[model samples]
Target chain A: MTFLSGLTPYFIAVFCVLVVGFWIQLQREKKPEEPTGETVSTSKARRWVDQDLQDDTEIPAKNDEDDDDDDHGSELDLPHVPYAPPRYPVASMLERSQDFYSLMNQRRSVRFISPEPVPREVIDNVIRTAGTAPSGAHTEPWTFVVVSDPDTKHEIRTIVEDEEEVNYRQRMGNKWVKDLARIRTTWVKEYLDVAPYLLLIFKQTYGIASGGKRKTHYYNEISVSVSCGILLAALQNVGLVTVTSTPLNCGPRLRVLLQRPANEKLLMLLPVGYPSHDATVPDLKRKPVEDIMVHI
Target chain B: MTFLSGLTPYFIAVFCVLVVGFWIQLQREKKPEEPTGETVSTSKARRWVDQDLQDDTEIPAKNDEDDDDDDHGSELDLPHVPYAPPRYPVASMLERSQDFYSLMNQRRSVRFISPEPVPREVIDNVIRTAGTAPSGAHTEPWTFVVVSDPDTKHEIRTIVEDEEEVNYRQRMGNKWVKDLARIRTTWVKEYLDVAPYLLLIFKQTYGIASGGKRKTHYYNEISVSVSCGILLAALQNVGLVTVTSTPLNCGPRLRVLLQRPANEKLLMLLPVGYPSHDATVPDLKRKPVEDIMVHI
Candidate 1:
């Protein structure tokens, strides 16, 4: 039987990912040069995303806060406004919930990836979606580095495997390694090189003000974690697959390799691309809802 | 003019929140008994949600991973198969991106909340959605405490405000307090009582094995942060509003109040509800994208 007839449901998913990947390549070929001095192949993908945000016309009116309700009034010397959001009927609400939940449920942690090209705009949209995550004190303590260069990926792979080899060979105890056996993961990481994009997420412990002053970031880990979660959702929502690969504090080397400022620390290294035709995940189980939640 | 004619867009928002509040009250009034011995109002909320998950027939076949592909084979002992996701055309993909982006963009931090009760099912669904977020080594590492108790909320509020009073009057430096001026926030937080639910998210620092052995959780902060972020999105996606209030290390008091185990620590205390008819957010500004992202 053909691929479609053999796994009808599964092929539908694969076909979608392939079509998007194909579409992205077509868009890239149409316009070889981006205005920001980026070649279509690997333009600083982030610069284009920044460009989208810069070009946004939806800036909330500055003086809108003046319309604040007198009942719950503010004494601050700035404008405020009454806030109201559209409400949907119970049916629409339930429909949306199911739609989003079902979409999210299909997402899985993928390991085997193909060295296929992804459109820059897709990555840009994912990061932009991630940036929407709320931060502590609005510190927004996260920076995304998109690496499409083979040389950089190779270097990253080398260092990460070095750490993993040590981890598998000595650092991790019997229990840890044994637990990973179901997933059948080893120190070898071919996906690091095979995947076309390596998105490095960094968390800024503090911010540098205009005068070079140090501004502390509150709940940095929390803020970055939330953003990264959204990042994964964004990627999955668009049909891309990734594994949250943490190289056990490859931060020192990564910071130097990427030339990141000292304040920024490595949070997650995501190798993003299409799952190889032969990609597979270990059959793992999630704890049931009754086990994880307590209603009081 | 009536509320509707006076501020067309603003009142439309108010009417919606009010209608939802009214609907929830009606729902609670209709059913006054729940299996968990909870008052009909709160009990139906979570039970219905739990029922949804329990009734889900879409659990993937456990042995699907056994269908391994031999084409690009893995040496490990396992089965793998080709993964193909359905593809949408460019227009549809772009539309989805924009649709999700605008929805997220409209999400704001709400403070003034109506005591209008929210369905427990909604909260359960939101939490379940949040749980879908990937975590470090798949440890999950988060617990959600859904507190609808009035007495508990009152007690928690008193301590939090006590701490906040000190933070505003003595603890915070000038710049910090001054920065908050635009938001018009004070030590007094009446919303803690005004909102119907308090979702206190606790992060598990480590897991206690059956034999009382300590199992260290890797990247706990990162994992919990991502989960919390998804929690916020889940809430907003379902027409609810909340504030990510960090009671700066209220862990000690909360741990006591909630009677949580020692291993679990407070991460965030989110008060969830519909915005008060008079709710208003400060006209805050996010840093331009150019400032936050770098292309490498």
Candidate 2:
């Protein structure tokens, strides 16, 4: 009876602590108000282009500057990210373990690709594959935009080039340029148009509604990175070659061109398709396991 | 001749920049001889006992102090973190993508066990499975330390409990304690001894040698997290049930007990085995797909 009494306080203390923790978590869920820096009209005006160009010249000059906040137009009201636990048969774990080992060993990063156009179903299946990644508070703060239209691709290419020109010529200084020197990358912007599919990854830095306030995401960077990893693995698994292209200059330009909302920020541009028949990569080697692992 | 004349200057400029970048990168790789203000010895001594006790008691504590860098082992020489282009084939990509998706869907955070002993070969295969995670510069910065021996498991349990005790008693404030309420986690070291295998994940924060100077690793957090994800998936694929355990106080305690060399930091303690017959999880649901994905 005495031992039970002593343990009672500890149990009660634990229970009380847990209840309070749950309440605090619930309170943390309340969204913050919309940021009041730039007006809606000005923001939209900045991204709106005149949409005038010749067939051979599909580039949209970076000149649109509009601030319109009321245009929700088919804007995706994406819900919180999902965190579904897997359901596997316990009996087959050993066999599955062997299969996973072999599969992982065979896994590699693909740069060179065949020039064959990928089927739409294959792309859809890959996206579906990415849907399984776990996220913070189950808020899978990610968006995957697929672009296949030739005209849109040309427009994207043009805007991206305009941005890249600025980055390469002015924004990216000596250090940045030097770091990227070995990659043999150029702001040619041909891949944006040549690749059969352009998949744009957007990170939801903040969430906003038509009139509702904004919500803050916890561990946003970590959450997004994890999702990206899963997405990359999925794309690779399906036999599609992906080149992760970042629109360092073209985000705002493309936003106006694509009419993206204010809350969504661009993260990566993945051009997915067959690699050019003669595509070649730099000769690189991976660090040995001993250099990376420690057994303590 | 005209084309060659035009490209000559550009090539010269590129060559100059590459030489400078390599020099700078090599300079950055050198480690500082003097220690930072934080001393590892003091912090380790302080938490050593508390860690042992917390494991036996199974109390949930949050010791924020132990999270300090100095408490980890000796700092090692970190390699240059490189951003390289991926390489892989297109056809094999689709097959792997479907397999990963299926594997992910089958994953679960398991805590129950069946008391059945797992074979050494199975454990070896599972660890090998985790070795396949993609890493920055292909560094693969990870270590899997398996503990099945009765003595080692007991020692680990004691070390973990001591730290957890302090966390629940005084170190963890009411708010922090409350947040972890939903998950019924305790510091009981039983899982270490009871489970058939206890896999300790130690992340090489930097690189160190027997006598050579230490090296630095870039994006260490992101690198380790990806490795952990791959490890989790690998374990699941093999048919083993795992509980991803984070010891609030064991970081310093385990470093000392295991006599791990400087440079390695404990990341997670994963207990692996078959589920107990009546293992039950909290009736929690994942966030919706719409909430996680956004289109721009």
Candidate 3:
């Protein structure tokens, strides 16, 4: 009886310590799950083959590690300079619009790129025209890798073709219950090896400002894509042909093969040259302006 | 003793039911937190003014529901047709390339738009030119809503300015701890009211095919952005000036106001017209060709 009474305080102290420890442990486990609790039930569906194009660099929480923003940021408090772009008379403007539309409307994605070598200076000029496109905050966040080397092009073909086959095989396991022969043809990218110039476009996910700190290139993807549109226009004006392709799962390998820095990512790959004599395009019709534009 | 023994079976049965219920509850709670656990740590940072620009239509789990995709899917078989864009002589190609580059280099994001009424037909042709841009799987997922109605333009300005202020306030709470006075001037979007035409660009995240089933538009956002690039080029070709602005937090409100369907999210907004007489621009320089391009 005497020993039991003496040990009561010690037993109570141990009990209190155990309770405090458990409460702290419970708290530590509960923090992360709280903010994300409401998010689960809403994300019912998953992504298909479009996994490579998701660039969310601003978002560290990611998928396939391809998160990057569009190309640019503008300078703060830069001196404003007097500017006036040439204003065309209504008649000239009308004439120019019709002419530009006629030229662009004739442009099509041609896969049969001729092996004939193109002028490097002309290619440079096309890229220079592309660089003139506007970017987020004026951040010109694009890199044009003009690959003319035969061995390098072949290596790119190997990497891209391998990944493409894997993508087809993965799709085959899941939802793609189609004719395997027809689908297999899509996996073989012969143009990668045949083209005179392989234009591999990349977007700088972020930029290095002074002191080596990371500067955000907001809207980098859109800015780069827009630049690509101008490049296409320039190509059409100069009578060149190329097809736009986003190689499935080939970004990382191609990035490594090209020895590009981590800050850059593959956006589009264009095999550029004159079209083959037997060049062909998919028989598709574009929706007219009435179908695409709404006026108020 | 007999009565107590008789109640033991019932008590055991009740205990078993309680244990099973708790096990099921634990399982339900435990899931959903698993697939998303590694993701929480990386997403510590958040998007700022760029939040409105995050058009992730594919990711249904979203902020303000502006999330979408760059799009389209292809049919099993589309017939091919012979295609050969006009081929120019080398001298003509060089001259064309140089002329195009010179023209594109003059293009800038002009903010001060004159209120003079431009011809509607020119705008139509520009939109038509934009529609000609290549999209993911040929999905031309773009909508250019041209607002000339003074009332609607004013209403748009109000919505946009209000949201811009809110965005500013939200940034005020966060890391935008510099030059509030200078930044305040940017939020006052007078051009929205003064421009003859306001072009609102939307990327159709998914398309409605037969039977109202959603058809996936692969790379819809990128595709639409590319189209906008072409539209910009077209505008430049016609000597029209405009400023591209992504209204912060004004997407949903503007989407509802513009009566764009649920599948369409705003990608860009351009107030198009001639430059105001006292027009000025930031004296900015783009990276030279050597810096932006690499040869392998």
lDDT tens digits by residue: candidate 1, B1-296: 68747557544544554565467446745874432232223223222211101111112223323322222112222333334555555566666666666676677888888998877777777887888877765778888998899999999899889877765654443434545654656788898888999988887766665445555555565677778877777777888898887675467788779988977777788999888876766666665556566666
Q: Given the true complex, what DockQ would model 1 score?
A: 0.14
For DockQ, candidate 1 versus 2, the one ahead is: 1
Instruction: Report the lDDT tens digits of candidate 3 across residue range A1-296.
Output: 99999978656755654565467446636784542342233121121112212446434333322222111212233445556788899999999999999999999988888999899999999999999999866779999999999999999999988876765544222112122221123677788899999999998877776545566665688888889999999998898998887765678889999999988888888999999987767667999888899999
Error of 3 at B283 (Å): 0.6
Best by DockQ: 3
Provide the DockQ value for model 2: 0.09
Leading candidate by lDDT = 3
- Consecutive 10-residue window with the lowest summed lDDT within model 2 chain B: B51-60
Q: Estimate each model's TM-score.
A: 0.71, 0.57, 0.76
lDDT of 2 at A136: 37
DockQ-based class of model 3: incorrect
For all candidates, what are the clash counts?
A: 20, 76, 33
Looking at candidate 3, what is the lDDT of residue B140? 86
Which lDDT tens digits does candidate 1 get at residues A1-296?
A: 78658767544644554465467446745874432232222222212221111111112223323322222113233455557787767777677777777677667789888887877777777787788888866778888999889989999999889877765655444434544543557788888899989999888876665545566565566677788887887777777899886666477788899999987878788999877765656444566667778877
Q: Point out where model 3 deviates above 4 Å.
A: A1-57, A60-75, A172-185, B1-75, B172-185
DockQ of prediction 3: 0.22
CA lDDT of B43 in candidate 2? 39
